[model samples]
Target: MTSTLALDGIKAKQQKTWASGDYGAVAALIHPMAELLVQSADLSYGARVLDVAAGTGNASLAAARCGCDVLATDYVPALLDRATDRAMAERLPLSIQEADAEALPFGDGEFDAVLSVVGVMFAPHQEVAAAELARVCRPGGTVALANWAPDGFIGGLFKTIGRHVPPPPGISPPPLWGSPDRLRELLGGSFELTITPRDFVFRFASAAGLADFFKEHYGPTLKAFEALGDNGKALYDDIVALADSSNVATDGTLKVPSRYVEVVGIRR
Candidate 1:
């Protein structure tokens, strides 16, 4: 088992990496998945919902829009600040807090639904975070998520990044959350899981443009490049090539389709 201290160190680094670039630019393109997740959770009016690792409030705002009372939490306050701004602008019933995914501050059975969209999966301690997600939900409540499928574009993106700057050892990749079998192994005893594979199209003018945009505005991409130091240019070239290979657009513009799994579980 990984020591708690090392896990904490990884989490600290993750926080900095995610905060390094403007993730908002990348997140804005995935709004549809948020809506789909809210629907999958079947949240009703006045439902008490918790959005874990709710960066920029995509899931929280979506839930609030559907009449759920949402508490959006993350370890990074800067990201939470953006979520707060989004909630305020939309006049939604969403609250903000800085909380770790593995060590959630909410009470047991406190929420009717727990949601994460490309969120909680990134926690350094996967099992602990998964348990925390299940712990806070009321019996029969929903725990819905949208994770990047291991065979998808985003997964390939991370894999490419890993080749340049390998992830810390002793930690499971976040894409594992995208697997239904893995989700069952983690949460099956506590909840009945419903997993669906879906694709979300990411539009861009060109593969090179997309790569540049992500490296400049996406945290993980930026961090990977930073870690690569002088070899960062090769990483950028790899990303451009990856994006180009995944492009399904015929008109020159990019329309890359990334597969992700939508998981909706009912707590037992």
Candidate 2:
């Protein structure tokens, strides 16, 4: 077991990393995944929903648009600031707050549906985050997730970043949540889950363009590249190479299909 102190340190660093760049800009390309997730959650009107580790309220806003009362939470309040701005502009029933995925402040069974779209999977203490996700949902309620698969572009991107700036020794890789077997081990006790493999295609003008976008707007990617220091060119070249190798577009544009697992679990 990881010491509480170690976990806390990891969480603190995560908050800072996420707060660094404009994640809202990066999340925009993947916003459709949130719509797909909310559609499968089977949420009823007036249902209380919690979006854990919500980066700029994609899932929360989607749920809110369906008439569900949605609260978007993340440890990094600065990121939630963007979510709050969007919620206000859209007039959706989406509220924003700073909350940790591993130790959510809400009461057990407080929400009718709990969600995290490419969110809580980033929690270093995966087990604790999974437990909190289950704990906050009412019996028979829904718990939906969209996790990037290990074999996908996002996973490969992380791996590329790790090769340059390795992560802490004990943190569980976020992509583990992409596997059905791992999901079962972590969440099956509390929910009856339906898992489906899906792809989220990323579109950009060019491979180099996509790499630049991520390096500029994605916090984790930005930080990873920054950490590379004098070796930053290697990371840039690798990111470009990864995108170039996976490019499915033919007309001088970038089209990479990243796989993710969409899960809709019923609270048991």
Worst 10 residues of 2 by lDDT: 91-100
Question: Against the true structure, whose TM-score is highest?
Answer: 1
**Cα shift from native, residue 3, model 1 (Å):** 1.2
Q: Which ten residues in a row have the lowest lDDT in candidate 1?
A: 86-95
What lDDT is obtained when candidate 2 is compared to the true structure? 0.91
Task: Encode model 1's per-residue lDDT on 1-268: one tens digit a residue.
Answer: 8899999999999999888899887778898899988987889999999999999989999999999888999888998899988888888867899999999997899999999999999998889999999999999999999999999999999999999889989999999999888899888988999899999998989998889889899899998887788989999999889999999999979999999999999999
Taking all chains together, each candidate's TM-score versus the true structure is 0.98, 0.98
lDDT of 2 by residue, 95-199 (tens): 787888988999999999999999999999888889999999999999999999899999999999999989988888899999999999999999999999999
Q: State how far residue 13 of model 2 sits from its true place (Å).
A: 0.9
In candidate 1, list every pair of residues with a backbone clash.
none
lDDT value, residue 29 of candidate 1: 84
